[model samples]
Target chain A: MRKREPRVILSFPATVDAMSMESYSAAHGVPGRLIPLPTAISAGCGMCWCAPITDREAVERAARDAGLRVSGVHEMML
Target chain B: MIYLDNAATTLHKPPQVIEAVAEAMRSSGNPARGAHGSSLQASRTVYGARAKIAALFHCPRPDHVVFTSNVTEALNTAINGLIRPGDHVITTDLEHNSVLRPLYRLAAERDVALDFVPADRRGNLDYAMFSQLMRPNTRAIVCTHASNLTGNLVDLRQVSAAARAGGALLIVDAAQTAGCLPIDMEALGIDVLCFTGHKGLMGPQGTGGLCVRAGVEIAPLKVGGTGVQSYSPTQPAEYPTRLEAGTLNAHGIAGLSAAVDYLNEIGIPAIHEKETALMRRFLRGVRDIPGVTVYGDFSGDRAAIVALNIRDYDSGEVSDALAQDYGIATRPGAHCAPRMHRALGTEQQGAVRFSFSWYNTEAETDQAIRAVRELAEE
Candidate 1:
């Protein structure tokens, strides 16, 4: 088994929103990548923006600045 | 063959569009279905297309862009989804059957009341009738940006103003105008702009969509898997996901993305200028021919299309002569615009429609004009 670490996950209502989050992050140098929406967040099958716990503030700021419709921000160990 | 049936579908597409479609077919997977590389690639391509389409139409929100199989589907989605029972809908006689049929069905099945702004013999819409037709319960004004048969451009500014004053949603069918006309949906205050990729956009036939204004909540026409919200019984109440229920035509959308890129590179105004110039060249040559009677008002800005007939000859016969002897392709018959044909008094004889595109040159236009002149002389 791999070691677990604290992470931040940004979820969105739609795939387009998640795609927008991914695009904004790539363009603006935000530290995150798209991952499968954590089942615990919701039972929905979608993608979410997952970032390191240390960069949670940066992620939140980017989401707000980009005017992204983020549904939830969760902290968990992965 | 000299293909002049561009109002039906653009025969000449950007090389990038073809390559993108081919590449996508080889590599893409079901978008939003998984986090795999192929799925992600498809998702990215689709989102890229959505963003590009939103920008092209000047729609404020990219997420509001919803992909349908074609503009017909998009229009159906908009009309059938947003309109409620007993809602009063306004349309124009210049609309293609795509718009007319849906409204007709709703009137038949849902008790929706429909009013039409009339067209003149020259195919010009009576802008004043929009205000005259306004009702207290007017739910929407659905109109085409241009007539597919006569090519007369609808003044969205006038229509949008009437729609706004009446507090009705303005849904435009841009089948003949998108990517060929300068459309700023945001500036035009269009509530929903439905477009097809195959015609003016110069993309594949199966790809087209609608750009919804931020607050317009159009219910889904078809409800199924959206690849997201799989656990929910109801389709998620998101703009695109709400309208887009099934797996999208990702391959065609990739091509559409490239098509938009090409349009941006060349600029739509430049292409429009070229096409209209060709259209004018053809009009000048053929309009003066003896026994030729042209349809539509050409005194103002219009699409690069000219519909005419040689004397009382059947439009199909003339079109056949142009095709067989001259090798020039044009559309004949009613062109699926029965109301416009009736207005033009061509319901019996129909009309031959020659539409130009950015790829058409002066030489081709001249040849088409010569063919029409000779046909008229016969």
Candidate 2:
């Protein structure tokens, strides 16, 4: 099996806000997949976008340009 | 059978709406939770519905629209979220139970000050009084765009202006007018709009929502799994998601989306013209019935509902006769609008309401009028 690596997850205040980030990222071909908030993360909403830990800066920059209000960002091993 | 209780729900949906619901059920999954094809498809269908609703209501962004099971839930969310303890709110006598009960609950439980601007016996609003009733602490001005019981219309633009002058949020219950009549959210400056898809929107039951303006922030009424953020103790604080929680009625939204598409193709003004014309026909045909009494201002601007009663019969009896003898379905007994009935002095005898829809025909109109006339004669 491939070795599991730690990834970056960005949580938003609302599901729609997270989805907006997903939408913007896809249009710009940024790296991230919206997923159920990782249990390792202590956020309130049910969804967050996960990207390779290396893609943190670009993912966040994309979320910012897209006007998404990220509640928190976490790095955790899957 | 003739269905005249459209104020409750429109029974006949445009064929496309029916197909869309089935199509969604067949292929879609939880939207936004995953990047899988099914999830993306569901997401698109929901977004498409939101976009169409935004266009119809003149909402600036599709994301501002939040889906709920029905308008009642939307109203509850808006009322519960916006009016906190010590907040003052202004509503009206023409409100349905959906608006009234929620405000009433907030008043009792949260220590909110509630005042209702009384309407005239004909269901005409005292628009100027809305300004007079605003307190320094007023947080919301909530009212219905049209009275569900009498089909009387409120000039929402005027109400919006009053709310703005007081720096209060204007929340409109567009349950009866959303898809049937044109609403320009920007022009009207509505802070929150609550609507049901099953009524004039021509969608299936169990689909409705609220549209929030860009700057107005409301607390979430309920919090649960949003299929996104699983870790927070508090609800997510975003426009639609801040308001919408749990699994969305995606299948119903699929129908609602298709329904909005149908409404767009037909045009709201055209639909309004057709429904009200039929109502006027029924009115004119039955106007001479000796024992009959009608409610509502027959002013040009009106909803597709007509409320009335025969002299000797209870509103329920009249409605029962219409349904049993004439095969005409109507709503009777206060319409969950007890305050409006009290205002109209129909407190003891509730009114029978005959509401129309686009699919109804001139033939059905005549039959309803004739039935009322025959009942009057008997």
Candidate 3:
């Protein structure tokens, strides 16, 4: 197994919305995938878009271009 | 079995619909909950379903289409969310329990004044009577787009005009007619359109929703987490989240979207033509059977459902005989529209309904007609 590292995640208001974000990004060829909201980040019903820390700014810009809502974006260790 | 209880639930779903549901479950995740590819795919599936539903219903805002477990739940949300204590509302005999029971509870608990515009024995509404019943404080007019018991279509334009003049919101239960009939909510001046996916839309069970017109504010029936606003103590005040609480039946909606896609490809008028032609064939076959009686005003547009009776036979007995003896399946009794049954004087014997769909063939309709003929002769 490979060593793990903290990755950037974008939490959303609702699960459907998080999925919407992912869809827009993929359509625009942006780099990211949706994952279950990290439990350490206050237990809630939400999903986040995760990508490389290096891609954070690019992903944020993609989200803005696609007009998707972002709850919060954070980088935390796995 | 020659299934004819479509008013209860459509048994024959298009193959694409069945596959789409399975595909969604296999490929998607709890959308909006993740930043991963699977979750993103799920989110897209949900959005696709919402957009398709909105387009089909001609709802201006796709976000206003809120998913519920079924039409019953959607109707409850519409009724309880909109009607307040001391408010006046109107309905009619041509409604399923989904529409009537909520109003009944609201009338009992909230002291909401309720009035029903009576229907003639033929399941025909006197639109003029609706004019007489309108009042200044009437908050909503909740009724069915088509009668589940008799297959009669209401003149929604006339009903909406009444609702508009009286300053009441028109909430239509489209359970019986959503897929078969064309429902342009804005063009019809409808405030709230509630529907189930299984009946006309041809999706699986547990899929239904409401299309809220832009400015019509219906209160949220349930409040909880809406993935986006986790910090908020109450449900978020947006379109879908304001009404939708908890993980939606994403799997079922996936199926609903596929069904909508199929409907769009085939066109509603083609589906209507096929189903109605079958209905006419069955009706003509059942005619001249000595003791057979048909109910409802078959004068204009209607669903593919036909309610009938064979002289003095218990409706259940007739349905059972058809099922066991003829390998035909049908629904008997009041069909959850007890008031309509009463109006048709089917209080004691009830009625046997033979509903049709695109999957049904002319041969099956003929078989059912023959079965009823045999039963009538007995």
Candidate 4:
């Protein structure tokens, strides 16, 4: 048996920015996955990136290096 | 104008929805795929939202719910992913363009046969008609849970039972009923449930998804990078990642999650009771008006969407007057369901639609009734 949890999530100002972050992170070998922004954060519907909490810095750096705009970052037990 | 066309997109979202989007934008970082503190928080937020939606739909597994831009995209994903060329699909006349257009396109291009089960004059689906329409080539039956134009709720249980008997998958478009009605995906036997977040869900626009049943494999509509499978060129074969490609609408999801929470806290049954009561009131007021013709069954289970027309008054004219003169906003015309209007014998004239939500008060319905009464007199 195995267990799973979502540790890190990123929010973007615009859908394109979030999309660019996904592209940049993937191209640069960052660890995370794009998901619909969670309800805990908002009741509106949109997408966000989710990953293990530990990979935050590398992914952020990669997003910045790729010229992708970052909105907000959070750590939660999911 | 006083907003009344909620079926198109709900106006005035709950305060929590706006706050959640802002907070996510301000605090959370890239989720799931990231490893930092902010990303971890963001991931948790997304998971929490998924759980909320799963709870809303009574889905056993949140992972089965895959996000999309809107119900159209969700419907497209389910229809295109599941039906191959030469496969048969059974649908209904009450379907919106979202469901009709894609199925039509697939029929023309992919050589699939689409059978439409016609709705009766009252916008009710005849299950017997649906059973007769089934064929060996019928691999799936996609139907809207409610009519967007007339607010007629289809008997999903009957349809699902038919699908089960025929060994076909049942896909339901829950766009109008997801938040306004009580829907249990597992209990309904619905193989795929497509819904939008902006309407009854109380979320902002640009949020929708498909709740796919376990063991059902639908091909990905778009393929790119899923943040996972950095090594694989093709899309990954997982529940959500398999379907979700490219960057998701994080801000929208945050808002949607908040909307779902608001609905949950308020309780869907309560919302349903409130909206339906208002609908009944509105219908009763207009039912006896000499010049007004109301569509759909007033006695059965349905959403709050009401379609009507004043005698000798064009639908668009009434809608425009409702907006310009009375400051009451409503949707006019075919309501993106031309076939539905045609079936109801109102295609040429269309109809003025007043779709209600929890935000609408009894006073608003009274005002709408008065406005219609005035229009009828004119």
Highest TM-score among the candidates is held by which one?
1
Tens digits of per-residue lDDT for model 3 on B1-378?
888878788899999999999998888787555545776667788888987999999998677899999999999999999999999999999889999999999999999998898888898988987779888889989999999989999999999999988888999999999999889999999999999999989998999999999888888999875666577687877678899887788899899999999999999999999999999899889967899999877667789988999999999999999999999989999889988988888988999999999889999999999999999999
Ranking of candidates on DockQ, top first: 1, 2, 3, 4
Q: Write the per-residue lDDT of candidate 4 for residues A1-78, one digit (tens) a residue.
A: 437664787776434455556656766788987776666765444567788988888776776786654557888766
lDDT of each: 0.93, 0.87, 0.86, 0.84
lDDT of 1 at A59: 98
Q: Comparing candidate 1 with candidate 3, which one achieves the higher TM-score?
A: 1
TM-score of each: 0.99, 0.89, 0.89, 0.83
Kindly provide the TM-score obtained by chain B of candidate 2 when compared with the true chain B: 0.98
Candidate closer to the true structure by TM-score (higher is better), 2 or 4: 2
- Docking quality class, candidate 3: acceptable
Question: For model 1, what is the error of residue B169's alpha carbon versus the real structure, in angstroms, after optimal superposition?
Answer: 0.9
Fnat for candidate 4 (0 to 1): 0.00
Preferred candidate (TM-score higher): 1 or 2:
1
lDDT of 4 by residue, B107-194 (tens): 9999999999988888877788778888888889999999999999999999998898888999999999999999998899999999
Docking class of 2: acceptable
Q: For candidate 3, write residues A1-78 as lDDT tens digits.
A: 657676788776555456567667878888877666778775765667778888888888887776666677798765
Query: What order do candidates take by TM-score, descending?
Result: 1, 2, 3, 4
Q: List, residue by residue over B179-247, the lDDT tens digit for candidate 2.
A: 889998889999899999999999989999998899878888888766554555666666677777777
Q: Which candidate is the best by DockQ?
A: 1
